[model samples]
Target chain A: MSSFVLFTLTGLGLAGLYFLLASGLSLIFGLMSVLNLAHGAFFAAGGYTAWFVMDALDSVPIGLRFIVALLAAGLVGASAGAVIERVLVRRLYGQHVEQILLTIGLGMAAVALMGGWFSYDPRLLTQPDWFGDTTEIAGANVPNNRLLILGVAILFFIGLMTFLKRTRHGLIIRAGVENPSMVRALGIDVSRSFTIVFALGGLLAGVGGALGTVYFNGISPSLGTTQLIFAFIVVVIGGLGSIPGTALASVLVALTQIYVNNYLTSGLGSISVVVLLAGVLLVRPQGLLGKAAP
Target chain B: MKRSSIFLFVVAAGLAVLPFVPIEVPLLFSGPFDTPGTLQVLSVALVLAGLAMSYDMIFGYTGLLSFGHALPFALGVYGTNLLMLEASIPYVLAAAITLGGVIVVSLVLGSVALRTSGVAFAMVTLAFAEAFSILVISDPLRFLGGEEGISLASEQVPDMFRRVVNTRNIYWLALAFTVFTFVVARVVVSSRAGRVFEAIRENEPRVEMMGLAPFPYKLASFTISSGLAALGGTVYLLAVRGANIGTTSADFTLSILVMVVLGGAGKLWGAAIGGFIYGILNLRLSTVATSNAIDNLPEWLSGPLSEPLFVLGVLFVILVMYAPGGLSSLATKPSFGRATRRS
Candidate 1:
């Protein structure tokens, strides 16, 4: 029973990481048809930036250092996202396939550059002593990192929801999603909103990456890619553009993976998640929460 | 024959007779063209060209951007290896059996995956392939070697493929396979079903409106492409004499997509060209990475220049941006490629 509690919390932590990626992927795809294959690269950028900052700040206070690292990662990722959009994606506007291909190339190139710079070796991110400790919940000793990551993700989720509901840019993004041409017909430039979405997506993925280092225990060149696969499954099963759907699916996938691995065979967890995806896709092609395709 | 076909035949003939020629190319090769080292590289390149052509059948022509295509190819590799080692079967019989398995799996997966369209289809296929990759790496039964993978038993291989010394025979086999696939793809691309595939790619709803079922055609393309990929995998296993988990990766499928696009999609020969160039570059670029010229560069610049994948990835980006028409498009006009002209 205690093990089950640990598993659930760990699963929630994993779900938080997935949400960070899926939210961005879902929104970007919802507004623009682009799949953003380079999203994992954005995540990696955040992770590496966090790792770098954390390592370089040995003289700084430990608690504040990680905070600074996390913020730097988000900022770097946001900038990178905005730049990639303006340079590569903006040129291929409306050419969905070409845009996707361009991102693929960019993704490949960026990951390889990271590998070249840092190699594939896993690097441990330094955290405060509290991160390593655990808190008891109902007789279960749950790791503090898990709770921390989950808390951070939840905060981000609420913040994102608020932004989406309250801000003018968010309103523009939502309206643009429904009908880009209609929004254009209303004399509002949707292109600026595209840049904002990219930046927002980058920020989420970046923060996720830093938090993911805590979740996964280390950072590697291929780290983003391995997690990206599960995130893709989450996005697809959650339905393309729905934030709430992405959040729900992330929880479903992470919990299923954790429980199945503990109760059943170990590696079957990932396979079962894929199985879940296949089942969902077969039943509802648009996904559980996604609207039916026009 | 048409001028291009005649030229292609002459080139094929020259390649066929290349084994007997002891001539050397200056910059491209470290040894004579027919040497085992060179033949080995050429064989892999030729096999990739063939593989790329096979991928074109579905992705380029039929408009299916499947991310699980590696599964069929990986099946051919592991199935043949396991059959040869565990069952004590000969290579040919094992290969044939694997081909049968590939057909069945592709048919089953295709029917299900084809149910969705656009990005959904890509995800479904990717999911299936990832499952396969996971299963292979997991190895519950312990037959499939985990990450390092399994190799074929030496005694089980045919005489002509027994050792590195027999690389010439394998190279010849690769050349023959490439030609066979190219010819098959050419014939199929111009056939009635092929016309239907292009039509589906252009506009599926319109094709459906014409009272024809798109599912069957898509499935047919899927199966055929799978069969070709499986054959390439068999050739690959023979070349490297082993199968590993990397072959089952989504990265492999993406590379195939890159090859198809880099050459010019919907153009069969263009895909082969793309595949061959990428294969050669992939194998040979490591030499460039370690070369003196690149070593002389600044540390920041030289570091990335040392990685072959980095160079290839950047090249992929530049080409996508500037030369979206691909290598073939830069050479000659695809006069009849009206169906492929969209961005």
Candidate 2:
């Protein structure tokens, strides 16, 4: 019973991070039709920013530190996204390969620059005093950080769903994804919409990264590559341009990963995940909730 | 003035004489003294070049962006290692087994990965490769030798020729492989079937409308490309003196698609040149930079970006900004950069 609860909590916590990372990638692809490989870099950057902020303000209260770090990461993500969208991504719209290459390049540069700024050794964000302490929940010993992650994930899903469904910008985003050419033709300034989407996506990715530092206990230069691969896998499994699908798939993948890790040998566990993914593709080429091709 | 014949003659002469030159200075233009070390380097280069060339068979010819081409490479290397260590098989038999193994694996994996196109295909392949890497790296009965990796005794080359393999002979072996691959790839590309591959690249729907099943073509290419990639892995193992689970095969960047793009995907020569440049940059240039002192640069700038991820970024940037069609365009002196006005 304890093992089951532990596995479930772990899965949920990881799913939150996955949703944070993959949501941005999915939204970007939906709006731009381009795969931005560097989305993972934003996640890494956010984590680093958070870590830096906390270190610089070493004496601050843990609650204020968390808030300040989260805000810093979000702002950095948004500013970087806006600048990148205007200067680079705008020219490479519709060119999927170029976009992948460019983002991958940017990701690499970010990692290298990070290594230069912060040594190769990994850095971790400290958990708040309230969250650092462990708790026994439903007969299972759970880390407060894990609980925080789950709460954040749930909150993010609710907030994102609400924003997309109830807001004017959200409606514009939906319309853009459905018929981008039409949206542009209608003089809705689709470029402006794209910039906003990119920034929002980056913000989410940043927050995910910041949160991830608490879960993983650290972030490294190479972490971006690993996270990038994981995020890409989640995006593929969930179906592009579908937030609901991303959320569900994130949980599914996390659950499967945790279950496999616990139940099977590590080698077989990985193979099983791949096999499961392959099975999914063979059954549903467009993903579980993906729109059927015309 | 037979241009083709002259080109062949020049290539043959360069390969034949390149090893006799002094060992201290790497030949700028292929003369004597291209020792066993150089030959080993060349062999590894040819192997990678062959893999890249075959990758072009799918990626370049079919317009499929598969980030998972490394799957076949892993299958080939690990399969050959198993054959070599478990069966105590000779190199000749082991090579054939590895090739066959990769073909089967590719067909099975491709059936699943090839179901989708564009980004979906790329994602699925990448996922599979990741999974495969994890499987090999994870400790399971030490079959993949786990983290320690498996080592081979030696190749089954004739005893007399073994001496020739020092550095120069290895270069010859590499050259022979490169030449053989170049010839085979060119012949395949020039065939009627090659035209079908090209058509698939241009428009799959149009080709299907003409009553051709694209799956078979893709499967065939996947198998053939995989077979060649396995052969590349085999050569790489021999050159490196052993195989490790995490080194190249498990590293997410094993089957470098960017190099293929940088070199020119469809062109065999492009693959060769791409591998050659990569080798030089990785082995010679990195070594020099690491060893030599840089004037007035910060200490951080001087460190080796030995991590594959670091170089990949730079390579991606160069490929994206400068040569979309690859380095083959540079070789052909094509007017590429002139057209993109970047509004």
Candidate 3:
């Protein structure tokens, strides 16, 4: 019973990271109709940036450095997103193939540049001392970091839901997702809103990447491609443009992966998630929480 | 003869005689037929051209943006390797068997993937490819050889595939396959089925409303393309004498996509040209970076310049942005000219 509880907690903790990555991708896809293939690059960049910050700020307290690293990652990702949106993505609005090719090119460029600069070596980020300790939860010992990640993920979920329901900007994004032409006809700056949403997505991805490095123990240039594939699975399983769907799908995928990993080989765990994704795609093409296509 | 036919003959003749002609270019480049090294690069390019042409059939002609095309290609490579190395099958027999296997696999994949259209199709295919890749690398069956993959040398297999002695023979074989791919692709694009494919690409719903089943057409195109890609993979394995996990990676798929798009989608000749250019650049860029010329460059500038993929990425973006029609358009009239004339 304790083992089951432990597995569930671990699954939830993993789901938190998936949620952050997939939500951004889902949000961006919903609002802009642009599939940002370079989304993983931003995630990797965030993690790399955080690593750089932590390394450079070795004299500072670990907790303080961690906070700074997360912020820096978000900011850097946002800036990159803004520039890419303004310069390249702005032109290829309705051309899906062109957008895919362009974004893929950008992704390859980003990864190659990162590889050139960082030398393709994996870098580890140090977690705070407190994060290294474990605590008893319902008679099962749980890592402090996992609990912390779960807590943060819940807060993000609530905050995001509230923002979408209550805030003006969030409302505009939702409206755009539902009907961009209608929103534009009503004189809302849909394009500007798209830019903001893209940046926000990048910001979330960055935070996820940075936090992931601390949790997973290392960051590498290939992380962009790896994370991108995961993000794709999450978004596809969750349903495109559906936040709640993404959240639900992430948890499902994470849990499936955890149980599979525990019972089978680690490699089989990866394959199982992909199989799950395929099953979802075959059964519910629109995703679990997504609306049917018109 | 018609202008197009004459032009085709001339191009085919040039390619046929290229390996025999010992032409050499200056420092910036070398002819494909000039040296052994360049010939090897050109051979790889020809195989890639075949792959690119196959990709063009589905993506360029049929309008399906599949991300799992590498699956068939990888299957062909592994299939050929297994038959030749383990079963001691002849090269021709192994290739035929592998091609058949790839078609069956592709049909199965197409049935699942064709259920979804547009972006969903792409994602589903990608998922399948990723699953296949993981399974191969995981080596659950113990036949896949895992990350190190399998090698096909004379010691391991037959004498025909010996790298040193059969370099020229492999080069010619790759060329033959490339030409065959291009001709077949051209024939398909001009055939009745190709018309249906174009119609599907232009508007699937309208085709369905017109009482034509788009699914069968799409599946047929996918199957044909997969077969051709499998052939390309067989040739690639023959030339390189090896098959690895990277052959089935997303990166390989991206490279094929880049080649097809860069050459100009829907144009078989353009895809072939694009593959050749991409292959040459990929090989030559690394050589250039490590050559004596780069040694004179400043340290800071030299570091990033040494990576070929960086340059390829930049080129891909620039080409997509400025010239969507790719090098094929440049060979003809400007795209803007065509647009203005159409209007």
Candidate 4:
């Protein structure tokens, strides 16, 4: 029972990162149709940014330093996302396929640049003392950081839900996903919302990266990329553009991975996740929450 | 056209006779042109050139953007290497078996992945490739080789292709493969099925309206292209002398896309040249990165420049945004920057 509880909680922690990255990716692909291959790069940048900021905050209290680092990472991600959209992605505006190619190039370059600045070697980040402690829950010693991640993810999910439901920009984004031209016909300029959606995604991924660095105990140049593949799986398994679907699928995929990896052989977990993806595709090609193809 | 064919023949002839030449090019080669070092680099170039052209069949001609092209290539290298080293199969038989395996594997994966169209198709294929990659890297079964892939057994390799001195023979095989792929791609592109592929790319609904099932044609393109990539994989193992985890990576698939797009997607020769140059540049740039000229520059400017992927990646982005037609179009014609997707 202790092991099961530990596994479930830890699994939920991992799901937090996937949710952050996949939610952003789904929103971008939903409204813009750009896969944003560079989304991983943004995640990496956030990791690096938080790492650097916290590393330099020798004067600050450990707890306070982490809060500052996390916010900085999110800020850096948002700025970069907005800039990429305004400068590079906006130029190829209606050419969604071309946008994919462009993002691929950007992703490659950004990751390479990160690798160059920081060596391929993994760098362990500085975390607070309490974060290193374990919290006993139901006789299971759960890492405090794992609980922190789960808490953050839940808060972000509620925040995302609220923003999407309450805001006018959210309405425009949702409508854009249904039909861009129809939204435009109603005299709404989704062009501005495009940048907002991109930034919003970057903010979530960036924040996730910071927490990922904390969860994994270190950050490497390739960290974002390895995680990105799983995030893509979650996004596809959940319906693209559906926030609630993304949230639900993240938990399912993460739990399955953790449970299998713990109970079964080491590698079967990854293979099974893929098998799960294939099974889903075979049964419902449009995805579980996605509507039929237009 | 006649003049261009003659020019092509001249270039092909020059490349074939390169092994016998004793002369050296200064910075690019560490030794004479025919030496093993130069030949290995040239051989890799030829192998990738062939691989790029094969990718073009599905991506450029059939207009399917597959992120899992690396799967067949990785299988080709890993399968042959696994058979020879672990199972003790001879090189000749192993390669033949692997090629057969590639055909079946690609066919099955293609049919399932092709069920979804466009971006969904790309993601599903990627998931499959990533799964295979994890299998190879993690080594669920010990024969797959965890993390570090296996090396070739000298005894299993035939007498003609062993040791560093025999690099020339491998180079010749790569050349043969490239020429074979070029011919096959050209022949198929001009054939009836090829027309259907282009039509499907132009407009899938229209192609369906024309009483042709696009599924079979798309599947055919996927199989043929992956078969050639697998064949190149066998040759790649011979040239590089081992199968590591890098070839199976999604990044490797992206590089293939870069090569095809950089050269000119629809044009076979464009992909060949683009991949060939990319190989040389990829190898040479590593050498250049450590040079005094690069190291002397300010860290701010030189850091990103030192990474080879940064250069090629930026080049890819610039090309996509400004010149969608690629290098071939500069000579043949210009295309307004638009990624090839059905209207």
List per-prediction Cα lDDT, in the order shown.
0.87, 0.73, 0.83, 0.88
Error of 2 at B179 (Å): 2.2
Query: Candidate 3 on B117-210: residue-level lDDT in tens?
Result: 7887887888788787878888777888888988873444456557565677788889889989988988898899999998887778899999
- TM-score of the A chain in candidate 1: the value is 0.99
lDDT of 4 by residue, A85-116 (tens): 99999999877667888999999989889888
Candidate 1 wrongly placed segments (more than 4 Å): B334-343
Worst 10 residues of 4 chain B by lDDT: B334-343
Q: Where is model 2 more than 4 Å wrong at Cα?
A: A116-120, A129-132, B1-9, B23-39, B155-165, B246-255, B292-295, B303-312, B333-343
Q: For model 2, how does the per-residue alpha-carbon lDDT over A133-168 read when each residue is reduced to its tens digit?
A: 778878888878888888988888898889889998
Worst lDDT 10-window in candidate 1 chain B: B334-343
Better of 2 and 4 by TM-score: 4
DockQ, all candidates in order: 0.69, 0.52, 0.56, 0.74
Docking class of 2: medium
| Tens-digit lDDT track of model 1 for A106-163 | 8887888888788878889998999989999988999999999999989989998898
Please estimate how well model 3 matches the true structure, expressed as its whole-model Cα lDDT.
0.83
Candidate numbers, best TM-score first, in rank order: 1, 4, 3, 2
DockQ for candidate 4, C-alpha atoms: 0.74
Ranking by lDDT: 4, 1, 3, 2
For candidate 4, the per-residue lDDT at A99 reads 86
Chain A only: list TM-scores of all candidates: 0.99, 0.95, 0.96, 0.98
